[model samples]
Target chain A: MYVDMQTGTVETIMSNSDLPVVLIVEDEPDVAETYKLWLQEEYEVRMAQNGDEGLDLLDEAVDVVLLDRMMPGLSGDEVLERIRERDLGCRVAMVTAVEPDFDILEMGFDAYLSKPIRSEQLHETVDNLLDRSEYDSLLQEYYALVEKQATLEATKSSAELAESDQYDELTERVAEMRDQLSDTLGGIEDDSDFIATLRGLSEDDNN
Target chain B: MYDLTSVLEFDALSQIRPGSSILISGPAMSGKQRLAYDILADGIDGGDGAVVVTTGDGAGDVVEEFRSLVPDMNDAQLGVIDCRGDGGDQAVGNAHVHHVSSPGDLTGIGIGITKALEGLHNAGNERGRLALISLSTMLTYTDKKTVFKFCHVLSSRLDSAGYIGVFTIDSGAHDDQTLQVIKQAFDGMIDVRDAEGGGREARVLGLAGEPTDWQRI
Candidate 1:
């Protein structure tokens, strides 16, 4: 697998612009400018008139992409391929007029939108993807702590674990994250404790 | 409530409602796959129609295992969506068997599930139990983002259809970030590991109070 290991997150990325980065890759200058105008308030919008420009603008700092599929030189599909190949870890939505076909099964887009999409749709999609990315960042940190504690438990002697200040801090961090997650998860049912959090996540996606 | 005593073989989670998606994450040899199979077979034992989308194992072998678990299993109801692309779709023992050339054919798998559910319902079972043996294999064919969407899409489908779903993954196969992202797609997750006391144990995550408490299996 070409999956890169977890070292940093999109949220942790530092850039000159404080707002999250949104890349718009459309062939039509008018459409690109429209998207830029709509998103510039909330995001640091970067316009790419073509696929090559899109690639040039893409980086780890980019949180989401509004990709046009019918570009001339390099299609949106190819740009998507290049994005994944580069492993930028950014969410992409293929906003195109093209009706989806069975071949979409093989495509790696996070979401698909028809060309007649409204501004609200764009905002909702971008917000949802950003939320997902943020949650993923927290989860990564949580698991990193849990795994660290697990490794200590597996390899260290009881006395060693008790004596090590590092181990003690590790345990504390896990507890803190558990509490944070619980607060985020809301109520838990006896039968569906774990599923309940998933329900919360689903709700978060919607709202 | 659907009884899970046959699956967990303990009281940690004795009953779970239908339409819930559970993910089991554990490193190699942690018995996660075994638990997944147990959950699916337990449903079959109780006469719920079962579907297995096997990407790593052969369909014949999977069928044999299911039969072994529930002897005199309902042959007409079990559905196997073999994505190994080794053979064409067919009916074996009057069971609904569908094949997609590869795991990349997500639409085919989706269609396969619809047919499988219909076949089971036509055979008189009102509910279905769906299990994707492992997502690690699916991740190999696509990026983490796409895999995450696939899980959400599949889970939502099962939820509306009122079916139970269980997906599994190998912990050591992917990075921590990948695991974290995919973990959000399900309603709950089961983390399996070697118990300090000597046997295998599991703890459920994504819940309130003491959700990480591990129980021996």
Candidate 2:
């Protein structure tokens, strides 16, 4: 995903394949390290002690964030707001020790867990958030491919209607575009099914 | 007057009262979820309808955890809201399971709880129902003002419906200003922590028409 430096809208581009990354923002060293230990096996984990650091880490390839609610500078909530404002694609889950007040729930976090975090809850939240993010990314790629295919089809139909030498050249270009679109669409479908299978397996394992 | 000690000692958090909001505050890894599960399980075992809304964890994991503890909880009268998916609520056999994608989408949570309670009320059941979970995840994703508003709406709805509401919070997450705003909204507050030994301890910080005590759970 690429962020427009000025508008801050996320522009996602299709890639070959990449490992999901998790950004851990916590001032407490012990806590951050603990999350790293738990998540590193499945994800490429990155650490930041405060929100400012987390923002810097955001320049990297982060798919999800395990943000500590409290920190010395730029608290977790502040960082999250900035991320939303930038339209970052990264999912965030608040890891804190605050009571579950209704006010907190309305703030729009993906998930919340009180601190002294459980290994199970931590892993579950990260896995679910990452899976959701990946699914969303795949869906976007699928739509883009569909749009490209439709555009190519429209160009080809118009070229046929004209039946001129110039139109024939346009038809050749459209065919190439259609092949490319078909390849992209097929790849996305395969990825989507893989993600669905992963989700089903995880659910069954939990059960 | 109504044998307060027995109710406090034997009954789970949800059985304390109808339309009461109970705040279960504690540090992380303090077994808050376990306590919440136990309370819901107790209610289910007693044939009182219950709902568990999980923002961070999957409903299946929670169900599995409960099974690990009680073994017979699969047959219990409990409903779960997964709140992690976009479409359609699924019912596990007779129990209903709802999915929510974000913490901001708590309308689903409120609706699920309301439906459960209405069913119980229609059945002429006055034993009370429970909504157990946390809002910490929601608060972290949004701003303080939005969270405060969400809480106000939820508290008022639960209050009017007379359903038993218990939620956990992490004290270290909020500032004094934000904490005060939340404290004003709750009807009852139980401060839970690890005692000197291995067992848990709880102190009632505030309650409606009841004396406060800094005692153990």
Candidate 3:
């Protein structure tokens, strides 16, 4: 809605606080526009025709990124790689025509929606991603790791998983994440402070 | 002012109470989801707090359909812990909806349920219903014993909070031992199957004064 036709500029839309930002990274103009149209009413929709443009538009403030696979020039996967490298902390979903295989587990995307996705389905995916934003950063990473384990576990046998170094690394990574959570939350650094935190949340459900 | 189970239209379901967890068992496409949703629908319409842990379906669409069932939706309390492993941001239009990446993330799902329950209680709705859309999806990712233990813990959580729990399963999807193991978490079961001639019929199992007749659904 804030699109400037000539300069391709996005003006401040209602001060940006009223709406969560959604960036659509698709090479196809029509597809990009359609997604934008679907989202613009509720979100401050930003569109990128290619991966580089998508990255240029991305910022921590942006809540979700819908990246198109097989985009010419620095593909979606490569863009995803760069995004992870940057540590922007936004949820990325691959909206791709490519068939999802075990290779997808290697890519660091929050969700996968194969093309020919319905309007409502796209809306649902976006909404769910935002809900994910409420979780602490560690949990976000933890669940992504879990998703990969399940994805690979489904397509491969136990012997195959035992043999694959990638699977081993994934398992190690998941274990490390769990250790981090326990390390951060497990022990009482100060008993009084821990008790105070618990008191804030305590409800006597004994009834 | 209604008792937890008295809101349900079905007489057998109406006999259920607070702190009860019941499983709906049937083959694939046998209308088990409908029966469970109906029970939940009635509970929400009667002003109960509701939570749904979904694996395959999007929480937004599920909430959308659920709100439709309750004419007083604006006043209803609902929360969704979506475990379909997909993520993004849209205001599921209403209610507290949290996401976990996959069924494999049981810890995340557990935390989500706790947060949702807090939200509901904060909103002042006391009695409630919690539904796990299907356990079969979780069964695919975890072992039978793990799922059983998770159900046991979840049922106890609901009991402590004074909420009814309705869960579904594809009876044919898992082995008999697995089915028996998971069923132990619940006080009763709604066994759905094909009627003698046509349509679906269900009977309450494991409850005192059990409904022996297959009530046509």
Candidate 4:
């Protein structure tokens, strides 16, 4: 195997302006700007006045969505539904005044932070969601592989997995996904533990 | 021909091939981890870089145990992943010892494993091998699905790099379904058992061109 045993992490090619994009979709103008003020230094911030405007601003480029759950015209829940329907992979944190109830469990938002949000809570929610989002696709692929492996194990033998081309392709795809995620997340400073772990698992795919 | 390491020392397989993964499973007190260390020691002895990911013991303790078994072992030949962090204070403070946040942080553990492998590679060693000690401990931290996914990604990475990936698990700790799901990802299995005469015996299954007979270890 051809192994590149140099530095573990491939430095993320980053400029000052290349921060992760965050979209604030609060109907309240003051609240939206407050969020912008708090996050603009670290993230590329965008503001949408309402749900309709939020939908217009929504895209793959948006890394996170600070969604107000109860808006006047189009409710935050409806907008969240739309976001899910569109399969936009952006992390959504339901910023709401309503105390969380049993029904909130059915929602697809990555996090649910009640209203009167403190700066610390907001920052943490966004950061945690963003970090989770980095591995979302990889985790999906991993679960898919497990499901496939389970099905194969029930009907077939270990030799089959070793011999099957589909299995090999899935394995290769997973490795590539991990590498891609690791490469993308290589920028942030505090992920020293993560970077070190990635380096430990590194091996040459070309061989 | 590549040596099958301590496995060959026990059962004497002719050749097991690179890029193949093996599960060494037995009862709790069957010395499964010791067998894993022996395999890693063989790789190290052959000048193949070794990556030992410990989800159970601290790296220092693991290294100490390894040195006890193989007295000539050199620290340079091995890379350690200390996943069993006790929180607050750091367990390891060296380049060779990469610490993950915790055993529950599978993503961090994944990253640590890759980084350790890269370290071995940068050290000018070409043929690298990996060993993950005790999957049972990993099972304690997360759900079966997560652990299964971890193994899938990890084994796939090892396979693409043509590194022999070895892991140990207690056969009694998991149910049949769990064991079967975990076993599907590996190329073979070495089921070790304590014989009536007090010594241990092993049976190899699904390894490329290897015998499936129960051999005395």
Best by lDDT: 1
Candidate 2 chain B least-lDDT 10 residues = B1-10
- lDDT per residue, candidate 2, A2-121, as tens digits? 888999987765322366788899998988899899887777778999899899888537778888898898988899889766656567788888656534434546667787788998
Question: lDDT tens string, model 1, A6-73?
Answer: 95334432355679999999999988888888888999988899999999988878989989989899
- The residue-by-residue lDDT of candidate 4 on A1-207, one tens digit each, is 233458554443222256898999998898888889899888988889999999998886888899998888899889988976776566777888877853353345556788898888889878876765555445555556656655665566779878888867766765565566446644223323233223212211101
Q: What is the TM-score of chain B in candidate 3?
A: 0.92
Go through the candidates in order and give each one's DockQ.
0.04, 0.01, 0.02, 0.11
For B1-217, candidate 3 gives per-residue lDDT tens digits of: 2242443335555556666788989999998777777777877877788888888778877788787888677533888899987784656865888888788666567667777887888888898988898899988877654565466546656766778888999999976656755765567888888887888777777765756667776
Q: Judged by DockQ relative to the true structure, which candidate is superior, 1 or 4?
A: 4
Off by over 4 Å in 3: A1-207, B1-12
Cα lDDT, model 3, residue A133: 51
Q: What is residue B45's positional error in candidate 1, in angstroms? A: 4.7
**lDDT score at residue A185, model 4, on the 0-100 scale:** 48
Is model 4 an incorrect, acceptable, medium or high docking prediction?
incorrect
lDDT of 4 at A37: 89
Model 1 alpha-carbon drift over 4 Å, by segment: A1-15, A98-105, A158-169, A175-207, B6-9, B17-38, B45-56, B64-217
Off by over 4 Å in 2: A1-207, B1-15, B67-76, B86-91, B118-126, B208-213
Fnat of each candidate? 0.00, 0.00, 0.00, 0.21
State residue A168's C-alpha deviation in candidate 1, in Å: 5.0
Ranking by lDDT: 1, 3, 4, 2
Better of 2 and 4 by TM-score: 4
Better of 1 and 2 by TM-score: 1
**TM-score for candidate 4 (chain B):** 0.89
